[model samples]
Target: MIRPVAVIGAGPFGLSTAAHIKASGIPVRVFGDPMVSWRDHMPAGMLLKSTPAASSIDAPRRGHTLADYCAAAGISRLAGVEDIVPVGTFISYGEWFQRELVPGLERVRVVSVDHRSAGGFEVELESGESFTARAVVVATGLSGLSHLPPELAAAAADGPAPTGPVSHSCQHHDLSRFAGQELIVVGAGQSALETAALAAEAGARVRVVARRRVGFGAPPWRQPRLRPGSPFGRAWSLWALSHYPQPYRYLPARTRHYLVRRVLGPLGAWWLRDRFEGKVRVEEIDRVVGAEALDGAPVLTVRTRAGATGRLVADHVIAATGYRVDIAAMGFLSHGLRTRLAVSRGTPNLGPGYVSSVPGLYFTGLPAAASYGPVMRFVCGTEFASPRLTRHLVAAHG
Candidate 1:
């Protein structure tokens, strides 16, 4: 019997996994616009938080890497500790990787994935084509998962129309459009701080209203170390988490959950420190009591850490809040399949080999972070996820 697999994302994990599957002698079809999120969602001129070495897609075979693309394209091989990566450079590298390694990747969107009655998965595409495969891997990156606070969501709904003053951080590709206007950015993470700085540089007067005092990450290590590299900062704990992903599952569930959340909590990148400080005003508001639209402007009522209440008015509100992965938000999964898949804290619960409760069904990337650990949340995660998943699949069916 010929067993084939369908990979439903063309991002780093999807492309990496598909490349590994093909290398393992298994037939696979990978679908989606390559690097769509990086190309369309992120603002131009944005820089990656990860270093050059960690910001690569893992190819099963040698010769394909971000460094290779940079060398071939005559761009600076951004491998130095002080070197910062631009979003466009990363996207171009991914496109190059797909072309060279994961050729035949379909640039079509996956409409739905349902279980075939006999066995395997029935996949539908936006072009109205369909096919059946023995397995399907959900590698869709942060799509349909941008989170907004409840108060902000309600205020956005109360407007005369959708897409009002309130917008999630992922929705904007160009921050320069808000020029000469007052903008309020919420949250203190990299996205929030970077967006605030970008908006300011774009000529928008921006203030970041975060619940907690802002924090910046330590500068990247200037020299190589004995331990392996990780996208997360250089810490013994992070090094352990990066290297021992499979073993991380054995720890208590609460411990796993806490590490995932706290290890990389709201902190700005080191490079962003100069641009964000003194450039953007950061208010450490204790809580957002209410958000309302008054005469088309946004008003945020908040209490300070000192327990004083005040209001901030801005022409628009940008919630730089990060994404939250909930399997139910993935509309492509059929009701029957989604209902059957087990979940932990809104993420798909995966067993060994990253397989969900439904046989041959898999979840990687952010959705798998809960089960796999913090490494799954970054592009470097493909280094671990791709080979492991491919090995399991090839052994089972090849």
Candidate 2:
């Protein structure tokens, strides 16, 4: 009997890949709470940066798009690039997709995955159940990869918590708890800007500190029409990056890494511009040099572009600095297996079909960004990743 393929996550990539694999008549086991990250890590009233047209999860069959979910659930239809998708609506869509297509998904945690001496992998779940799989796909998106700057890590010594003196933006699900408090949000990205806007709307006095000028994407109506549209945005470069990710792995390592980080860099959604401007204070600084807890409050020492230094104190400091993909941080992989895998800049070095150096071991989502370009970092990339990965699994193992 062929052992089932083990899918280690339940987000867009994992669910999409599982649906495709199962559609090909391959036995598979998917493990994780459906849309757990979008439901738990993000704030209650938050909106996705991706436009409605780019927010659907990839499925092997038709009628499983976000539009289908909205129509069936009686929610307002979302079709345009200008339409903003609420996190709640997207989560519900993901759950609906799971129910309709990937119904056998296991809502349990996979504790560890280790390679067997003979072949294949041994997967152990939190429930003390163990199983063997012909292959393993690690689609755990940004779960344990929150990147907190070293300057602010000391202030958050208590670790990331919603109510702590200093915390990462991913720690909060409800910004209402911070009402009436003073907040210092660090970063110019969507997460930082949107978190500041939400906190201010919740009655908190909010200020955003960034290393450079904050930027907002132009409204859909204002965008130039000459270039083709891709999930990242409308640009020839973005179009190529999103449509031809397979060639991305062939590029030099430095170029791939630089493009992944530089493309789609820190910028907020156009709709958020009105809510953020004038409502939240913005300060451009050289860098955050230090942070400390003083008198039960967080104080940040920052340098200016002009070489001047100053300190700012706030009731709480949020490090909305985003995530870094480090395979080592995925504690589910045993030390022996991790050291055997080839990685570049903390990301797995993936080949065709998103397979890593170790055979039968694959990664997708944020972790695949370095090898597959910035497209893998968004929900829309699953359209490219899922079908190709399914084909590889069927041809190799089936």
The lDDT values for all models are: 0.86, 0.92
- The pairs that clash in candidate 2 are none
Candidate closest to the true structure, highest lDDT: 2
Q: List the residue pairs that clash in candidate 1.
A: none
Give the TM-scores of the predictions, in the order they appear.
0.95, 0.99
lDDT of 2 at 164: 74
Report lDDT (Cα) of residue 159, candidate 1: 29
lDDT of 2 at 94: 97
| Ten contiguous residues with the weakest lDDT in model 1 | 154-163
For model 1, how does the per-residue alpha-carbon lDDT over 264-364 read when each residue is reduced to its tens digit?
78889999999988989878888899888888778989999999999999989998888888888999999999999988778887888888889899888
Could you list the CA RMSD of all candidates, in the order they appear? 2.0, 0.9
Q: Which candidate is the best by TM-score?
A: 2
Candidate 1 positional error at 93, Å: 0.2
